[model samples]
Target: MHPREATAARLLKISAGNAYDPDVDIDWDAPQPPGIMYAPQERLSLFGTPLWDALTPDQRVELSKHEVASIASIGIWFEVLLMRMLLRHVTGLDPRSAHVQYALTEIGDECRHSIMFGRMISAFGAPAYQPAAVHRALGRYLGATAGGIQTFAAALIAEEILDALQREAMADDSLQPLVRMVSRIHVVEEARHIKFARDELARQVAGSSKPRRLYCQIVVARAAYTVTHSLINPQAYAAVGLDPARAGAAAWANPRFRETLRWAGSRVTTYLQELGLVEGPARPVWRAAALL
Candidate 1:
């Protein structure tokens, strides 16, 4: 095998131990709560809108599941990208070959994640797969950009922010056992993924021209803000048979939702702060954007 392929195989072996087969591992018949099952305030606060109050308890449960699944899907996609990038870097292989391999791996991972989430919805008989409009748009925007350092920086921000959520979900005692288990497992692997992204980004940024570096930073920050805002998808309300417009407006106005929004925002803020990107004008932007 090519060295990169060997590396990927090794990583796959490691991941297999952590691989959760939803069909066999997750109990699809678990009892679900009837009311809104809020994630910890910290997790919810990441949004700018008041999603907590706008949602009925049951709706909240459905939205929460969707949120988790969204993150997992993103992770699977990131790995697919990473594996392709690695192949190009290591073996001088055609990018097409790398892309093909990456696509296969991503499809498999996404399928498993979808099944795991689908089973959770089955248990509750609730729809838990609402695609947040903002998220879709932001994803498309990022996809349009040339994939390189800028993409890597955005991925770094995204992974760190998500790691915070996964960590909280794993540790929160109120979560269902299955939910906690999934969160714990995801966080473990994601740590390595985030480190790889950050290190790669640092190297890429350092090697770029100063102008390019600044531009990349600006794009990354803006992308993070846009994606964070998209987290409050109005369509989620509609999935549970609620009026999307009213629920979206109500979610924005609700104090509880605001609180959760702030909580979630802090995770991103904290990550930026650690990276020294939260100073000067960026400070106010972070504060304003982080309403949870």
Candidate 2:
């Protein structure tokens, strides 16, 4: 078998053993424990801002709920785009190939994850927070046009960032049980998906010409900016009874939140930098996104 096929075959076997049905695995009906934050205190966008200090402890916890719901909503949005990109990726490829089969399996995993996110949003009684209109439209464009390495790079940006956050949440005993369980499930499953994307991306980048690699870099950087900026929707602030405009501005300007963005993105940025995918014009964009 080709080396790519060998890698895919290994992933496929691992996926077979590790796949989850979130609906069955999560206790959807379990009551959310009182006083528990939905995410880490430091992870909140308004953390260390005056806005954060003004809120009562209970209000801070509520804000965390809205923020986590917003993250899950974005996860659903990105997973849908990813599934579309994966379908585009498999077009004309041999359906029986291990690569194609693993891609299909990953799509199925994303489908469950989207549904799981929707359920979590419902459980929170929070509106499904969406990206701003312009970012939503940009995501649609990228979903249709992103191919090869661009697709995998974009996937890694969203996956690894969320994975980092979820990894922390799952291990935090102070968080809501619902959040912990959900994060645990997602973190476990996404590990395989991340490995798959990283492997495929390295292969594609290795074979790509300078021009194509540059194009992928620019596109992926812009997508990274969009994802980071859209993560904590202004609506999450609104949900917590704050002025959306001011809270959103604070988050963008907050040094603590900016540091959080860097921390969340550090792993993927290092990988992309090593692949030489973070150079050229993309460097400034990555810096602007606070992912450099």
Candidate 3:
């Protein structure tokens, strides 16, 4: 039996006892706060830039609202991809096994999260912010071929980054109630999923040969770059009355944003390193992505 079977069984028990329904948990009919930011000021990509100083209060709040919506939309996109990878990975497992059951439970949670994100975006009146065409194609490839340590670790990385952001949003009284509620729901559910992925990744790494481990390190690092880069779409800036091209450039070069990426990536990278998935070949990509 795999090393993580016990971990899966325990998580399955926890899920059975405390799963949430976003439809019932989040009051969709509740009034959204008018002209309030959806995230903490410090989490804004251009928070420390001159462009940020030039913006009026209403514009800043609008930016936060759209930015948060884009983040939730991206969460949906990644959830769909991870669900496919998880389902494929568990295809041949025994139907009654805890591992397979927990995988399905994770998928069920993601489905609810996606629906919640969709409703949240609509309620905020933001346009759908999808990944670029090239990124979508790359995601399709990863979802199909990536399994074992690579699949779970990549999902964990994505979840952790969003978790960091949502944790802050959930606690900041300056933000809208709708945003905080959604963030709270996601954070609580995703914590269990993250634990399951981390455990599975460690077990998979322990079983892999050196060459296979190296391959996953490089591939998963590339996937990490894609996920970090795509979290916020450039079009989100246009919604706040800024030129997307100029704002994109400014945000990309912003030291604060780069710092945020590095800080958010550190925990996942450290864990990946411990699992032998952060070797020499992967280091440069991580650096270039500003995640190192």
Best by TM-score: 2
Worst-scoring 10-residue span by lDDT in model 3: 1-10
Q: Report lDDT (CA) for all predictions.
A: 0.54, 0.92, 0.87
lDDT of 3 by residue, 30-101 (tens): 997777888888778889999999999999999998888888888899999999999889998897988888
Candidate 2 deviant stretches above 4 angstroms: none
lDDT of 2 by residue, 1-292 (tens): 8988998999999988877788788899999988889999999999999999999999999999999999999999999999999999999999999999999999998999899889999999999988989888888898879888989999999999999999999999999888898898889889988988999999999899999988888998889998899899997898778999999999999999999999999999999899998998898999889887
Best by lDDT: 2
Model 1: lDDT to the true structure: 0.54
Better of 1 and 3 by TM-score: 3
What C-alpha RMSD separates each model from the true structure? 5.8, 0.9, 1.3
Model 3 whole-model lDDT (C-alpha atoms):
0.87
Q: By descending lDDT, how would the candidates be arranged? A: 2, 3, 1
> How high is each candidate's TM-score?
0.65, 0.98, 0.97
